[model samples]
Target: DASWISNGNVNGLGWSLKDQMGSEYFGLRACNRSLSALHAEMEGLLWATSCMRDMRITSVRFETDCSDLVDMTTNPMEWPTFATEIEMYQRLQEDFEDVSLSHILRSRNGRADALAKKARNRGYIFSHIDQTRSYGGVLRRIGSYIST
Candidate 1:
């Protein structure tokens, strides 16, 4: 999910990885300059995908509450505004053996929505990754915060 400050040029992007049992194993929050909410969502997905690849996570399913993002990825030619982002997303998918994006109800995505809002309200400019499950002894990595 993504959040935009009303009077500023900053946008917050957040994403979380959950297991089949609905347990959140990983999550991220970051701030960036996005042209629109759709763009912010795309940025969040890109960051999350890169992180998954870094961790050697090959098969995954990404869920978002943004239906437009799903549509944009499914039919890239119809969304010219997000052509570049869609292209980048396709390139990232190549790293994984199987990957898919699906839309879920907003009510089912509270955690990610709240994280995005918190990052936007706090003006956080760095990426923070929280790994609940230990991945080869790598627990968590707190990025250096940059003040605006």
Candidate 2:
């Protein structure tokens, strides 16, 4: 769960950045909402922070196409209505030693985006095909699995 939730834009992983939440981040108005959400980065950052705060760790190398959020999270610069956003992000990022920012293309964010959308529509009341877990145990260590 921890790994899947925070796994950034990686090959065959989830969509990076604001796209991370997948379709769950949208609704019937998905198309328009997605574009509107793109106007800023802090929105997702805040949500991610909410999801990650229990780990008791800080400092992260955050990346995304949403440069506005990257700037707001790391630069301490003022953004319109940014204070609230930072409050959450700072809480999450504070565990890190250094929070670097990286920008990547949107194509890399599809899997996670799909998962997010699925979660939103289904209320996350069922098993996940992604094998996502919350206790950082989702990713099975090599040689630890076998067919019974």
Candidate 3:
């Protein structure tokens, strides 16, 4: 699963692939440079692919709030703004046996959303890192299950 949070000039991207037992392997990156929402979503997709490859995950479902992204991935072409990233994502998809991308409501993606927000607020860059409590109280209040 992937989530993206953006506030004006900052974009926070986060993704987690979990085992059946709910042990999450996740990554987060904060983009200090401003990017369009589509571009940011593409970046999140790239990160998700890298994570999936590193974990040796052959079949997986990716859930995101960006329906446009899901559509774009389904039919990739030379989009004026997101062409490069979209192409890269398409190439990455070929490496997996079953790559299912779905559009989900933001409210239903709370954990990943919270982590993205935390990454934006804290200026975090973590590749395959454990979940941490950097913003434990605020995240808990906002219904994020990130542990201390």
Candidate number with greatest TM-score: 1
Cα error of candidate 2 at position 50, Å: 4.5
lDDT by residue (22-136, candidate 3, tens digit) is: 3556666666544566777777778778768766788999999888888887776635567777778878888899998899998888877776766666654444345323242
lDDT of 3: 0.67
Give one clash count per candidate, in the order shown.
0, 15, 0
TM-score of 2: 0.47
Candidate 2 error regions (>4 Å): 1-43, 56-59, 74-76, 123-148
lDDT of 2 by residue, 1-148 (tens): 0112222221111222222322122111011122234332344444444333433324444456556556665676666566665666666566666656566555654544554454434322222221122234343322211111
lDDT per residue as tens, model 1, 9-48: 5677677776654345554465656877777888888888
The lDDT for every candidate, in the order shown, is 0.77, 0.38, 0.67
Error of 1 at 11 (Å): 1.5
Model 3, residue pairs in steric clash? none
lDDT for model 1, on a 0 to 1 scale? Answer: 0.77
RMSD of candidates 1 onward, in order: 4.5, 11.3, 6.6
Candidates 2 and 3: which is better by TM-score? Answer: 3
Output the better candidate (2/3) by lDDT: 3
